[model samples]
Target chain A: MTRRRRRLYFIVSSLTMLGVATALALNAFRENLVFFHSPSEIAEKGIPAERRFRLGGIVEENSVAQGNDGVTISFRVTDTAASVPVRHRGLLPDLFREGQGVVADGSLDKDGTFIATEILAKHDETYMPPEVAAALKKAGRWQGE
Target chain B: MANWHRLANPTLFLEWSRRVRPWTGVATAALLATGVYLSLFVAPRDYQQGDAVRIMFVHVPSAWMALFAYAVMAVASAAGLIWKSPLAHLTAKAAAPIGASFTLLALATGALWGQPMWGTWWVWDARLTSVLILFFLYLGYIALWQAIDDHARAAKSAAILALVGVVNIPIIKFSVDWWNTLHQPASVLRMDGPSIHSSLLTPLLVMGAAFAGYFVVVLSIRLEREVLARQVRTLRRVQSRG
Candidate 1:
């Protein structure tokens, strides 16, 4: 093959590959972009019934309650400005407690309570975890004190 | 200056990179220093989380670089295949290991952070799994380049591999959203703008810039080294012929 023809072949092939890869990336990110929202944002915007997303805040003190079923644990997650009730049916994290940062991934129930499919305890006081801190601070509910 | 042919010469590219390396290195160091200071000490601790948030300083940048490095490699690979430019091949070759290193750093730091917070060293969650795949892709690309005996053939094969592996980059990114995984989705580079507060964002952006600068500095230096190595080999061949 001539040099020109080879060069043309390379260009056409590479461009095709590039186009396909980029398209795949954009498509995936679009469908799966789960935004982490603070309790305050969830309060203000109101949780979308259909979209699955992450809600982050501190578990409010004395708000945790165990239902008659014994397996269902209900608690309130708050950023001080707003609070959302969270109900979980599984074992809680070792560090799970009141006044601790928690991120719950699930959707809000029709009555506005957050039904968490999975719960993660945001660890430690002196060392803030990135995602929780960023979400809280973004909502202007971050208490640095 | 406008002609693509001018950049086709490895010797010319070497000289150009040599002039740029010093500035790139300086900028990288300066940005890193500023980013570290801001992220570690200056940034306020969360009302809830105290100090562990500092890990983001390292984690976020490394993740960004991992993706950025692969993008750079893919672009260079495309250029090398299209123009058959020796400089482009070197550029792609130099970027692969560096991108891999960044991916490694991101994974390691993520594991460290995850352990303390998530109570696990590793999970087969979608995000983590996708990143693992990216790391493997980098390893495969680098290994493919090294496995081949001939330089031209190696470049061609590696370029093809890179183009193929480009599929994984998006998969790594969207895995969190697509699959029910432990890893969280992107907050910084989202369509609705960064979900992070300015106090936190300032440091994240600074660190990101530092990581980008570091990649450029290292890439240019490596590219220059590869160009010189190629020139030396060509010269040795000509002398052997004489």
Candidate 2:
């Protein structure tokens, strides 16, 4: 083959391999790609029954309740416009608290309560996780808290 | 086949790069402009994810580029080794730092996005760990290139290291799938349909294209710079001989 043809072949094959690698990476990570939804959106559209997802907002003040089992804790998460009840059975992160930004991952129960498999305490007071901050900003409720 | 060696001449490579660099730069800028707009404003907030999903716009593309750049470096290294092509050596050398930068960006953005979403700044999860290793590999490749004093010897040694390290790329990619980890599995480029909504997919795609364009633009520019430096070195050698 001519030098130009060989170069063309090299470029084409390299790009093709890149395309394949991307496809593979995306496919492999599909399930882990969780979307973070605000409470209002979840309430308005109604969360799917079986799909695992995430909810992020402030933990509502005075809404945290420890269950009789001691290990189980329940709380309400809100984004100011709406609130969703969350039930988590684990050690809450140190940063978790009422009026603090938080994200919970799990599925919605039949009764519409969020049964969290994981609960992430929103970072420090000044800190907003980029995703949570962006989501809030887009929703027009971001007050930089 | 004979003409392939002609490109080894630094002057010829410089001339070719001059012809290609402008178009790549323009294309990169245009793609990035469209991508940022689409990602930040046009794409609908994910029905499930809200606006925070926007992080994917920057995070995923950088990750893709990190992997892509490493592959480019590995291939260039292989070419240099087999053909003793000085231009290939320079191309691989030029690409290493850029690849390392992208890997760093990917890791940092992923951490920033993860802290709020995952509730932690770092995780030992399979996917995250592998990416961390990939970053280290990039660092090692760059260091290997810099540590050796003889340019040709350094190139040859680094080429071997890069080719060997290529094995880690597949391992990194498959780690999430093969092992249970906190990191999410794939979404857009899947065997099945993308799990994400088209609204989000559109922006993600635009951003990914923009990243690819950016890589080409930067690679071309850096390649041109390397060619010029090579020309200067040759001139210095000739003058010393005279």
Candidate 3:
């Protein structure tokens, strides 16, 4: 090919490749954008119990319970307006505790329990983790301290 | 455009970068000193994490600079390829090691933060994995240029590679939100506004500014050195041919 022809080929091929990659990225992004939901959102949407999602809120006071087997644990996660019961079968983060914020990644069972595969406990003096705080602010739930 | 070619003349770039070099260097030094002081001494201890949050001032800025440098390198590569400008390739080449250094800094600092808070030194989480890939991309880019003896061909191939690799940028950015990684989701770069309190925000932004200034200063130094080296190479080539 001539020099101009080669230059044209390079431009054409690179742009096409970039275009295809971008399309794929956007499609995957749309499908995979996991939106975090609060208890109040759960109440409103009635999101199917089978759908996986992130559930974030403050762990309600006096709602934590140790399982009889001694490894499993359960608690009620609250967003000041509503609460969802969550259960997990693993060691929680060092910062996990009642009255602190938490984000549990899991799917809900038919019985309305959030079966968390992973639990991230909130840290900091504020009631919310930074991500939770941002999400809360977006949802208009943040009461600035 | 022809204007792009004129702007990329090596002598012109060298002179321009040299003229601004001292200003950028002094500004970067001043900002870095102020940032370190504010971050290390002025910022209040986290109510919970205490002194550990100070790592944010370094970790966050390094990550941002890593991303920014990669972006600069990629843009330079594109400009060089599209405009047939040799100086643009040199700019991209100069940027690679700087980006790689920043990526390494971010990773090491992240590990330090993790060991104390998360109780583990490392995990093969998505966010971590993507950053690791970005670091490798920088290394590969630098290595590709070095491995090729023909500078023009090297620029062409490496520029194409850089363009192809840019897909990784968005992946690195959204990894936390897309996956349930051990890495925490973004607090500062969020749609709902930064969740960090003002006390932490102040130092973080200042450090970010310092890092950007440092990149400009360092990049100009590298670019000017490359231009000088090219002159030496050209003189040798003419002598050998004669």
> Among these predicted structures, which one has the highest lDDT?
3
- Expressed as tens digits, the lDDT of each residue in B1-242 for candidate 1 is 23568667776777778888898889889999999999988887654435656788899899989998999999999998987777888899999889989999999999887766665567555576567667766776776665565789989999998888887788777766665455656777767777565777789889999999989988888888888888788999899999
Clashing pairs in 3: none
Candidate 1's displacement at residue B155, Å, is: 0.6
> Second chain only: TM-score per model?
0.95, 0.93, 0.96
Instruction: Quote the positional error of residue A89 for candidate 2 in Å.
Output: 8.2
| Location of the lowest summed lDDT over 10 successive residues in candidate 1 chain B | B44-53
Candidate 3 structure quality by residue, lDDT tens digits, B15-106? 78889989989988989999999999888776446688899899989999999999999999998887888888899999998999999999
lDDT of 3 at B21: 88
Q: Is candidate 1 or candidate 2 better by lDDT?
A: 1
Candidate 2, DockQ score (0 to 1): 0.05
Q: Candidate 3: misplaced stretches above 4 Å? A: A1-60, A65-92, A99-145, B1-6
lDDT of 2 by residue, B115-164 (tens): 75556777555577667667766666666665565678988988987898
Off by over 4 Å in 1: A1-145, B1-4
Give the top-scoring candidate (TM-score). 3
- Per-residue lDDT tens digits for candidate 2, residues A1-145, read 8756665565455445445544544554564333367899898988787678878788899999999989999999998899999999986765576776777889898888999998876432122234655687799986544
Q: Score the docking of each candidate (DockQ).
A: 0.08, 0.05, 0.09
